[model samples]
Target: MSAVASVVSLVELLRGNPGSCRWTGGLSPVDLARAERELGTPLPPSYRCFLAEVGSCEVDGTDFLGVYRTPAMGDTLLGTVSGTLDARTDPRFPPDLLLIQYDGMGGLVCLDLSRRDRAGEAPVVVWDPGSADRGGPERLAADFGSYALRQCTQALTRGG
Candidate 1:
């Protein structure tokens, strides 16, 4: 599937109401714009379409955090969770694109990068969405789509 189609499918899966699963809050348009501005970059085209169509939060009618796609330098796009505006107060992960926060979950929501189908396992790296690191941006951009697919699958399996 195309990256955009994959994202849409992921969003639909998240919107599924499976028992305890619920629709949580999503980022407001203003908030999204502010985040993009803070990061000093435009979000990915596919991601923009996802947000515009499916929105930034789940549709199950609960208050779970949602995913937003950041700019793609090459293949990967930085991913960020909704409701985390303060990076200092929040334990922002190094590989920020892979970082996620679900409802009622605390601390950094870390996803196993190795479990992803396309990328090889290395140490979990916390990404800084606001600032691109030396060589890190390229890595993230390259692997972001696959990483996102893995994350959505994991979340669905785990009932997150």
Candidate 2:
């Protein structure tokens, strides 16, 4: 199966169990453009597909950040836009990285925007705030699609 299809199918399965996932809905092209404009760089192709297909979501208590909604309406709006902006305030956080998830252990899962493959996909990496200098962020996946596939598969495996 194609990467996008696999990710979408897995997410759908994960969402079948009520309360297992909370999705913010798919994002419009306009919304994507706005996010890209604000971020000052185009997001990776796989990530763009994810935002368009699933937007932001919390699956089995794990957040997979995406484009934020306007007038949030109490939706928390703690997705990619907000998370990246918030992290950028820290001197230690690199200015070009995009935050994708908070690993719940003082570590953040982010896209290494500076490093992209020929397919325009960025590496997914885990940055531990408690130990930034301890060998730097650990790479989690080659791209968002792989990372998300692993997450969805794990969530389903755990019976979520």
Candidate 3:
């Protein structure tokens, strides 16, 4: 199956199952485009398809966290809390990359997704898989999905 198809199927499964965290729609197309322009890179294909077909939704697992898609622009807004892990020590973390794109063809691309936080002292690294350097998009997607699921489970149990 195509990457986009796989993601859509996954969404369907999540939508049908109450055990998994639910997703609420996210940023609008204008916002997604703005983000893309600001970032100077296109979003991943699976993410694009996700935005188009699934749109965005608040995940039931994690309060207020979600993956949003923009059908018009074919972009995705991954709204989740940022987690930090020192790549040097964390074996599970991938290398630092601004954005990672996975085409479901066993191909992964990493883009620089660093931006200055509100404090502006240091840049915030969104996804860093434990490698000494940045890893592929598939890796980031997998890691983020895993983290989201774990957080969702916790949130559901806490009734958050």
Candidate 4:
């Protein structure tokens, strides 16, 4: 499937099975632009589409970070833009990594911006902060579309 189609499928799954997933609705172009400005970079096209189709969401209580629909709805530690800003304060955090989720294991799921493709897609990777043996971020997917597909499949497999 194409990137946009993959994201559309993911959004449909998230919306169709409300028992296992909850979504915060999509963002406006203005909000997306604001988020990009705040983050000081252009978001990947597939990821931007996902955020515009499903701003923020959780599957079985595991939140996928994105721009919140409104300022009042944002959590400093969970909203994509805000969370990334806060994480940037850490000297150890790489400047090109954009936080997308907490791995529940002292690891960060992020978009590796430094490895962005010519099409503007970044690979999803997991960085284990507490693992001395993990020399660098472990790639999770080729792009946000693939990552979203994996998340949707996992949620469905869990009886969503």
Best by TM-score: 4
TM-score of each: 0.43, 0.85, 0.42, 0.88
Superposed Cα deviation of residue 103, candidate 4 (Å):
0.5
Tens-digit per-residue lDDT, 2-113, candidate 4: 6667888888788777888888888889888888888889999888998999988887766788767456654332378888888888877888889888888888889989
lDDT of each: 0.43, 0.79, 0.40, 0.81
Q: Which pairs in model 2 have colliding backbones?
A: none
Model 3: how far residue 110 lies from native, Å:
7.6
Candidate achieving higher TM-score, 1 or 2: 2
lDDT of 1 by residue, 2-118 (tens): 555666676666556445343323456775576566544445544444445544443323232334445444322223533334433444344233333342423333333443333
Decreasing TM-score order of the candidates: 4, 2, 1, 3
The parts of candidate 3 lying over 4 Å away from their true place are: 53-96, 99-130, 133-160
Candidates ranked by lDDT: 4, 2, 1, 3
lDDT of 2 at 17: 58
| Global CA lDDT computed for model 2 | 0.79
